[model samples]
Target: MNVSPPPPVGRCLDMCPMRECKEREQQGRLFRFETLVGEGNWARGRCKMRSLPLADPSKTVKEYSRPAAGKKLSSPCDLRPPSVLLKTVNYLLMEVWDHVNERDLASLAEAYIFVFDRLRAVRQDLTVQRIQGRLGAFVLEGSLGFLLCAPYLVRDLPSDSYDEVLHAKQVRDCFADLMECYGMDPKCPREAEFQALLLLYDLGNMDTINRALKLPRGVGDSPQVQIALAVNRAYLEGNWVRLFRLVHQLDCLQACSFYRHLPNARDNALRVLTHAYSSRNCRFPLDLLVVLLAIDTTGMASEMCRRRGLAVISGEKQSVVFFKASFKDSGPECAGREYILIETKRGDFTWAEIMMGENEGEFMRPKTN
Candidate 1:
């Protein structure tokens, strides 16, 4: 006798013969993938199967739709221990970030992207796993240090580079996240430093400086905080000499964070100086400009002067001849060299040492002759 055809597969787990039936004798077959109802084709839903009797293949298949009670899913990253996550963050800061340089802009950008992604992953893990106490604080501090270095790395890159804006925005957003972390813990010793960095990051914004001033009594008194306030005040007053002087006092990371403001500050200073030293025959020593603008070399200072339509006379001492009428307002050009202050200070400590707060007092002290 002819047998009736088997029933068409339905949405229920038991209705689909393709699914492995748990009730059947162990065949060790793998479960087939299935798309659940209302979920698009791309959505995956796993199911435990039950077999029906061979005598009746047409019966409606039983549903095993609900997930097992009390079962939970977690990402592998979320499962990592606090120590492991902290180590990963430290690795990125100490090892991976050390080699990121400006030799190849494309490669530099790629390296930054890679390191930033890993750091972000670790940070997310710390948050999701609810890591707290000293370990969490250390990890957060390390991540903040990494964020603070972003501007220094990209400082020399041409502003028109395709990834420039993307890099800037990402760094700002990540910095804000780190600040929020410290904001939750008022007593963290590093919190004052990060708050000061926020002020330095936007020196032109009076609101940021004002908010910083209103912090708990002692925060405004911290060395970094005092320096950041001074820098902001000097910037508002067009006092480039005092501004760069205060910048020289900042620690390596804080100076790096403040580098972004250099171009605007320099531009504004040169504009004001144009009118102040207006005589066509009056000569301003390029060496003095170097000191005033915190420029690394007189050559770079001369080039910046030339760009702004000043006349440079070369001899025993290079000097710029300022004529208010000839001074071209060429907005702000990135003219300064890599911060020698950071380079010299960085040479004294390894990235690991910096992260550990080793010799912190010496590190933060203004370099003296």
Candidate 2:
């Protein structure tokens, strides 16, 4: 009788993605065997131990006796293979991966449309639910990366680049379709899509973000949408103090079920602000609320109050804490534009004080007694 010894186990290379293979190797090695023609229990459960390798125990051999078990079998499980188009899409994704890995933004921007087209093909094939389910994950990941890079890419283009463009509608339509996929699978383990939209809001691409925000979801109003709106308002109003102030407030915003209601509101707000900041949209609107939502500033909140000459007055429900912000000039620009921050006590409200100053170095004078 001849038997083959078990295979020698070897350490796996680092960063290998073959999880199942690694798991299988955790058990003892697999082996094979050959039976003699005059086997004692050929048709029976009886078995016999074959002759072990007679060579030196420590010596490696060119050949060995056959063992009991046969060759290891292929894994029974495999991911559903993608269609030809999808396989091509995967290849393109690999290219994008390489381009990104190489830090070649120019090449990536050039090949981006090919990736987009392939994704569109996959979207059309979604008439088959399994294909949709399988491909949606890949599509979402790629879409998120693309959306995240959109602001950078768009800003990089020449100002007149879009003047004669006819493809904007097509691109927008594709983006909408991709967003619909993300919406249908809200809990699909793809939070990046939601994160990307938040970035888009700060990137000045409100048109796409607004459309995505309108989709029905488990929650009526996404905190991301609210934060985006706040930042947008700050930009529109040209209030730099308010915008930067919002950045400070966002830093203090805890993910209270009573407030943000989302699990990762802080990170989400940070992403939005970072994206908006990266867009170089320095024009800030002075809306305190918008500034509060855009940046994560905390210590300045109290200083903001003192600078406005606003007294806390009272903490009662009707006589809520109130503070007003106004400039010394009080010109037409400063007339109705100045803001009042107030908290109510028992439903009646009173002015606490007034605040002024866009520059942090200046002092806020309280109202004269």
Candidate 3:
């Protein structure tokens, strides 16, 4: 019996740079792989080889590998079988998020990053393999959607260092892929919720508005979509009162989507209120400010006023004295703080409820007084 040579060792399998060269070669862009070590294992040991274009063999280009000195290797999760990847995703969503609240801020931040990376890797794998059907939908809709909404739900997580815009774009891209491959039903309430989220992300963009209009008939009429459109109108009209009222009507995930726009809304509302309530003799009640601005607390509302060049009157009736001349238009002061309405609404639903879109009727409607 002849023994075959041991399979070449120390080669990068997943995310190999030479994979691109092989693909190019298949497309008629011929390249020759040159081995730099013993046995000339050009086929498998890409880390020890370089590729040269056959048309210009004298001009060689080095194909960097994952195992190159000082380079970090790809995550082990990248090489996991599809079944294992699915189980890992399920574990993170079912086991981890259910008890995420118990972790301290430091641990929460670390956990968030770890979970995000794992989910991202899984998504990439599923996408690259063109996986479709039930498995793809589960990962895309449940795991991926949770990732999009998480930044808002989990507060103060040292996110300042990340590229938020790039992150949003990546999530949007994955969602688009999901819609294209799995086909979202207009009748599905979850679809409507996601459509509403996409619209809310950029309310002022006409392109976004047109996209919402183009959705199948009932989608635009869904409670979530209707609320999002109303919020858009309120935002454009600078009607802060109506805006916050509509915001209160949104479910937890929708509210999380709307969180990014809060600072601008608050700033604009304060400017208008300062002028409307401008008086040396009269003061605006902090309690009313809480309602009008949808702020979580009287203390936070008072602090916001103080930061904006208004005076907080401390007495039996806490009030803010806003002089139009004294009020400064310093841009949005509180960007990431939580609101009372959102917090209360958040408790009304669980992680699974939001992910799976269960209890549709209850989650869709705001709690009635």
Candidate 4:
């Protein structure tokens, strides 16, 4: 009969720290490779639980705004016991996955928010810690969901459309919940990814990112870490080309949604760059601006500037000038001059207040591109 060699003596025996404990160590002449058990023989004792599966993260945040099957989500987890809320959430998440895959962000938000609202609506003096844990996870899911939905939020919608404003508020509410729950005591597996996404969203806020990631300034060398850092480096150094490339090429890193938001992101960045120029000298080379905006023509740049109330002065050599702030000139053309200063708030809302609901006041706003 063929015999397989005894799985080579466990290499961990020498490195095992448990050998020092007399009570915990195996009762043998010399600490054997595999004789210890229980609290004493930690090194020799095999892992009790099965190995976890690999992290194949799915659904871009925007993708989760929709629910699966277009069918109303019926949280099957709402069984007799209140503890079954966890199961209900898991079921809703499954529905969330189905919706995101369908590219229906609206339905996705509704289902998750529905579940979250129900949990919050509960009036009992809840003693179960499991419910709290589920709430945290749900909040995380909603927060990430809005981060991806941010691009859509940035676009201008009809003010009269109640549906548009409602969606925006829903996105804001989720974002608020996310911020409130972000720095809690218990860490979740997806927290790292959420932090990475937040870094990508607010490229201008390096200090916040540094504190959040706990990394030395300008020192993200680990390839195993999320790719948001890579994008972060590019954006900070004004490497727009590389930043765009990284956005499109990181599906495996769970940033495929970044690619979807690329156009809006570029628009937002260009708008910021234009906004940064002093009112006195707003002129910039049209060709250079085109290259920086990653657009094909100066006409497009001029059109965008006009929409934002910036005067695009054309020069003989295809040079264009952008006015960062609208000048208060009394003329038929400059009638709406002051309103031009009402730049988008870019999703301004207090997280503490969001958690407080109406008690937080009515100044809630959604995040912009």
RMSD of each candidate relative to the true structure: 16.0, 23.9, 13.5, 22.3
Each model's total of backbone clashes: 0, 46, 0, 12
Candidate 2 residue-wise lDDT, 113-155, digit = tens = 4444434434443322333332454444443333333333333
CA displacement after TM-score superposition, residue 67 of candidate 4 (Å): 28
> How much lDDT does each candidate structure score?
0.63, 0.33, 0.64, 0.40
Better of 1 and 4 by TM-score: 1
Q: lDDT of candidate 3?
A: 0.64
List TM-scores for all candidates, in order: 0.69, 0.33, 0.69, 0.38
Number of clashes in model 3? 0
Which stretches in model 4 have alpha-carbon errors above 4 Å?
1-139, 150-188, 215-226, 233-245, 250-302, 305-369
* lDDT tens per residue, model 3, 1-369: 999643222222332235443554444343231223222444453332344322222211212222458754343322434565555565555555655653477556645655665567666656545565545665666665566567675556555534466567767776676666435332333567677877777776678777787777667788888889888989888899999998888877777777778888888999989988899888888999999888888988888888888999999989999789889767897466575656676675566456545533543354466
Better of 1 and 4 by lDDT: 1
lDDT of 1 by residue, 242-333 (tens): 88888888877777678778788888888888888889788898899888877779878898899988999998998988888888878887
User: Tens digit of lDDT per residue, candidate 4, span 235-328?
Assistant: 7776665776665444322342243434555555655565567465646676776666445457765665566566666558555444555632
- Which pairs clash inside model 3? none
List the lowest-lDDT window of 10 residues for candidate 2: 349-358
Q: Point to the candidate with the largest lDDT.
A: 3
